[model samples]
Target: MNPLNPLTPQDAPTPAPGVYVPGYARAKLGMIAAGLLLMGLGFSQFAEPLRLLLFGERARAEAVRVVKTKEGLPDQVLESDRQVTAALEPRDRSYTFWNEFRFADGQGSSFEVRAPVGSQLKPLYPLIDEEGLPTTDLVVYDRAHPERSAFPMIVSTWFAPGMLFVIGTLCAFIGSFLFYWAKKPIELPRLPPTAPATSTEKD
Candidate 1:
């Protein structure tokens, strides 16, 4: 038996002399494009306009009136009255809550504000006293325009952008791997047949 020849075919086919174009090239390009897109999306999160577009007025509003008192402590609180319409049935009736607060310009006024039911970072609803009074301060933009207001939610502020950035980074990483994989060449499975050996020694 020939030592050079194996029981199974060991030779692999040779490809054209130039650098090989991987079969997955298109897929790699797609991945690269997707990665770039995700990177762009991540960058957009830091932009003010995108933040405003995604988070709305809350992104630019100034927060105020945070309650600092601990449990069972005496604290001064603002009044937030529930305004409900009796025209409809109990379940069907609509209610509007309002809180009275003084503007920074030394003008005392009342703006509609509501406490959040639950939140991750900060409470959406204001801390209230025993008499349904607001215990916490709220965010405000223009004191003159109370209608443009909202309860603070950290998800829109910190969580959303952070999560988006993380996801985008992961996507970019995966995309880079795919791009590298696609750029790598695959060798052909076929190899050229070997020629008969000739003796180099003199006869």
Candidate 2:
């Protein structure tokens, strides 16, 4: 008996119950781990260089394995071996005690911070700084980050927006595995053919 309320050919399962269980379980765990690592990446984005340090150390190897572009480009775009120092933009954009309060004059009276916003964040590939600045050996690019301390992980590759597709692929693989895992089937013994249907004499 078909269990689906609206039956379809695509909904039908394979002849054998062994169609897809084990692989799904393995990939599911990997997908979950990937998701956790992905979340950790967003956390790193907001927290300033923390995500870089963490993801760089943890998923760096796996990340490098994934292609970043249509022609299989790497995330680490290198312009040169130059190192430059740049200050962070003080990313405490929050409702602190003063920020959360409203002034009687109806004007926002939060603590004003003096931080330099860079004109351009170009040519920096591997290590994006605490201020999301990149590290490349370009002189014009270094005017903002003149301090020459390089974040080593910047050159390690696998740090970019496109890596999300890699994560999606992992999810698809996980889904394929699960599709077979939940499948079940029934078996029956074969009935022997009746012997020639002989007629009885007594009527």
All-Cα superposition RMSD per candidate: 13.5, 18.8
- State residue 156's C-alpha deviation in candidate 1, in Å: 2.8
TM-score of each: 0.39, 0.23
Question: What TM-score does model 1 achieve against the real structure?
Answer: 0.39
Q: For model 1, where is the 10-residue window of minimal lDDT? A: 79-88
lDDT of 1 at 105: 23
Give the per-residue Cα lDDT of candidate 1 at 199: 72
Off by over 4 Å in 1: 1-22, 49-81, 84-123, 127-153, 186-203
Instruction: Indicate the TM-score of model 2.
Output: 0.23
What is the lDDT, from 0 to 100, of the residue 1 in candidate 1? 28
Judged by lDDT, which candidate is best?
A: 1
lDDT tens string, model 1, 109-180?
444433322232222344355666544443433344544444344345445655667776777777677666
